[model samples]
Target: MTLKHQPAYIIKMRAKPGQGDRLFELATVGMEKSGASDRFVIAREDEDPDVLWNVEVFRSEEAKDAYENSPLADELRDEIIGLLAEPPMRIPVHPYSALPAAPS
Candidate 1:
């Protein structure tokens, strides 16, 4: 059997004080509508309350684009932009696992 691969997106943001909750709320709404396989946030070290990292996985690049262009995502972007101290950083990733060299 062939292995399946999926695209992933990572976003790092530094929210303004007291804005993390609001960002989380906006992301929840957008994620619910994006049809993504998974999404979540990770807190940075150094106890930087404002620093957050979000990771989202999609089945395909088309799905990722659809999610990015969705109205809900647009709204979330707008909301998060207003609450961030600086622009959010984003990275796209494609991950795969080998199948034991196909038994040689």
Candidate 2:
């Protein structure tokens, strides 16, 4: 279950003025529906209410590319773009380590 060499990214997005919540909601829904990654997390920026970050680790680059280029993603992308103040930014990274989730 290691994401050691997986295609991972930290995507930064800023919502238009007061749309952060809506943006987060929609993005969460998209991620859940796509099931394109091994792990994905959405978090709000503590110092900036309008900013949100999406951290995702896909099983492989092909899976990542396929999901990103799919029609479902395209539609969600357009809607997401409309809620953004500006273009989203992505920072790629390599996961060298990971810990399994604890039991509920």
Candidate 3:
């Protein structure tokens, strides 16, 4: 299976005040539990600890849409939104090239 041309998202979230760690924790757990993406990663900004960048690559567009519309996703979204300083920003993209997954 190749991830070439896969749909992905780079979601930028800013946690409220000191909620950065909590936000990252919840987001990570949510991603892990969802099983919605083949590639999931979360990174914190160096300049601003409160800023987080979540990257996800899905197997297909239908899977992505289904995950986004799921009740579990809704619940997680609410929980995550409560910790945010502002609405999360989602940037969708298609992979031009990607390296293979590393050994587990």
Name the candidate that leads on TM-score. 2
At residue 77, give the lDDT of candidate 3.
Answer: 91
Residue 3 displacement in candidate 3 (angstroms): 1.7
* Candidate ranking (lDDT, best to worst): 2, 3, 1
Every candidate's CA RMSD: 6.0, 1.3, 1.4
lDDT for each residue of candidate 2 in 1-104, tens digit (9 for 90 to 100): 45887989899999999899889988899888887888988999899988989999988888889999999899999999999999999999978887888899
Better of 1 and 3 by TM-score: 3
Model 2 spans > 4 angstroms off: none
Q: Which of candidates 2 and 3 is the stronger one according to TM-score? A: 2
| Per-residue accuracy of model 1 over 3-104 as CA lDDT, tens digit each | 236777677888888887777666666767667544444555368767777766676777777777777777778888999988889897754543343454
lDDT of 2: 0.89
Model 3 root-mean-square deviation? 1.4
Find the 10 residues in a row with the least total lDDT in model 2.
Answer: 1-10
RMSD of 1: 6.0
Q: For model 3, how does the per-residue alpha-carbon lDDT over 1-104 read when each residue is reduced to its tens digit?
A: 56876789989999999999999998998888888888888999999999999889998888888889998799989999999999989999877787877899
Q: Please give each candidate's TM-score.
A: 0.75, 0.92, 0.91
List the candidates ranked by TM-score, beginning with the highest: 2, 3, 1
